[model samples]
Target: MTHKDILLVEDNPDDVELTRLAFEEANVANRMVVAGDGAEALDYLFARGKHAGRDASQLPAIVLLDLNLPKLDGREVLQAIRGNPATRDLPVIVLTTSAEPFDVEASYALGVNSYIQKPVDFEQFVWAVRQVGLYWLVLNHPRVA
Candidate 1:
């Protein structure tokens, strides 16, 4: 029942726009905070760099991560999140285009809550986003930090 922010760690502009549209169309109430790359996402999560003034205690409800990214890359970002006690339990969904078995296995091994391949079709993508919102934002119960 508690509404928390959603962190979107993605570098592609087109994908970002599509995600935004999907969330909007799905009527997801949580605010989406975008980080263009892995480093930026980490900065925001840890309250460093441009996000220095942010309250680090207030973490996002879930993170939608893309494997291919500039700077740190999603695997590194996932490791960092898991390594940090403050963010270890935060739900992370790997929303990526990669359908590779290794990628999926690696993500699961790194403690990703879910892994979803990006649908090429607009409607399918929207449906996936809606399902994600419904599950992570509305249904799942996270531990109170």
Candidate 2:
């Protein structure tokens, strides 16, 4: 059986490494496609730029997006995803450090499926990642493409 990859759109190296470790701790071994910034995430999703040759039809199980990013912000990326017909229905979860109500409201308006604040503690972070992985990859039934 093949495991569906998780699309992680983040710029911070430490956060990226922590996420990897968290997933590993949770036993979620699915391959992770890490995009350093929002523009690169868009490229991967739309099969443009360096990802032009990738199979655009096979979107990841879910997208874990960070709001603060370079090249393009997560809000723009979320808008792009929702605007495009092909990726409109894809599950996108906002995983960010921001606890601002405005940010939460804005993300929801942009069509994020869920909004989760990053856990500061490693154990809590690992548990959160595990739950998200299980729910999105296993329990949640996305619409058939």
Show the lowest summed lDDT stretch of 10 residues, model 1.
136-145
Cα-lDDT of candidate 1: 0.96
Model 1, residue 90: distance off in Å is 0.2
**Model 2 segments beyond 4 Å from truth?**
none
Candidate 1 regions with alpha-carbon error over 4 angstroms: none
| lDDT for each candidate structure | 0.96, 0.96
Give the per-residue lDDT digits (tens) of candidate 2, residues 18-109.
99999999999799999999999999999999999999998999999999999999999999999999999999999999999999999999
Winner by TM-score = 2
Candidate 2: residue 116 Cα off by (Å): 0.5
Candidate 1 clashes between residue pairs 3 or more apart in a chain or in different chains: none
lDDT of 1 by residue, 1-145 (tens): 6678999999999999999999999999898999999999999999999999999999999999999999999999999999999999999999999999999999999999999999999999999999999999888888777
